[model samples]
Target: MKKFPMTVGGEKALREELDDLKTVQRPTVIASIAEAREHGDLKENAEYHAAREQQGFIEGRIQELEGKLGSAQVIDVTQIPHTGKVIFGTTVDLINMDTEDTVCYQIVGDDEANIKGGKISISSPIARALIGKEEGDVAVVQTPGGGVEYEIDQVRHI
Candidate 1:
């Protein structure tokens, strides 16, 4: 199996979710299903159907999280020595060459990528371009609009 690169924080969050699913959600759904089943005939039971659907969804999520955690290779950026080059789990500050706009992004695993959170996936175009690039290096990211050049200002392993 291919190992997925994940930040320490991401792994923790996933583990928490899995725990909640297995301990809280699973039991709650089971209880709901039991109660629904007691209510009426299985053929015309809306509550039972809804509960079953919810149980299926919860189980699916639990399995997904477990699989991800099993295949995860957690990287604690804070524990690693800070290097000038950009890498996974590193927060990089970039300056747009043309617009002169400065932005910061943390390269993270796919599960942790959130644009609003300033986290980008490792497979993203910008992150792929920034990977292995040192401070003062220029990374050109090809977007749907066009190519955008960003100057690596700083890289922080945090």
Candidate 2:
């Protein structure tokens, strides 16, 4: 099985979701199903059907979370030795060569990637180009639009 990389915070969030699913959602759905079944008339039981669908969804999420946790390779960014390179879990400040716009992004696991949160997936084109690049280095990223250049201003491991 291929292991998925995850930051400590990402892993914690996933674990918390799993715990909530197992402890709360699973039991709540089970109880709902039981209550629905008590209404009788299995042929025309909308509540029972809805509860069953919800149960399926909850169980599927639980399994997915468990699998992710099992195959996760959690990395603690703070514990890793930093040499100013833009590796995973490290935030990098970049200046767009064309637009001259400065932006900061943290390369993180796929699950933790949120552009609005200043996080990008490690597999993203920009992050791939930024990897192994130190401060003051130029990274050329190949995007669908065209090739874009960015100058690395700073690398922070947080």
TM-score of every prediction relative to native? 0.97, 0.96
Best by lDDT: 1
Clash count, predicted structure 1:
0
Worst 10 residues of 1 by lDDT: 76-85
Clashing pairs in 2: none
Each candidate: what lDDT? 0.95, 0.93
lDDT of 1: 0.95
Q: Kindly list the per-residue Cα lDDT of model 2 for residues 42-105, writing each as its tens digit.
A: 7799999999999999999988899889999998989988899888899999999999999999
Reference-based TM-score, model 2: 0.96
What lDDT tens digits, residue by residue, belong to model 1 across residues 124-149? 99999999999999999999999999
RMSD to truth, every model? 0.9, 0.9
Clash totals in order: 0, 0
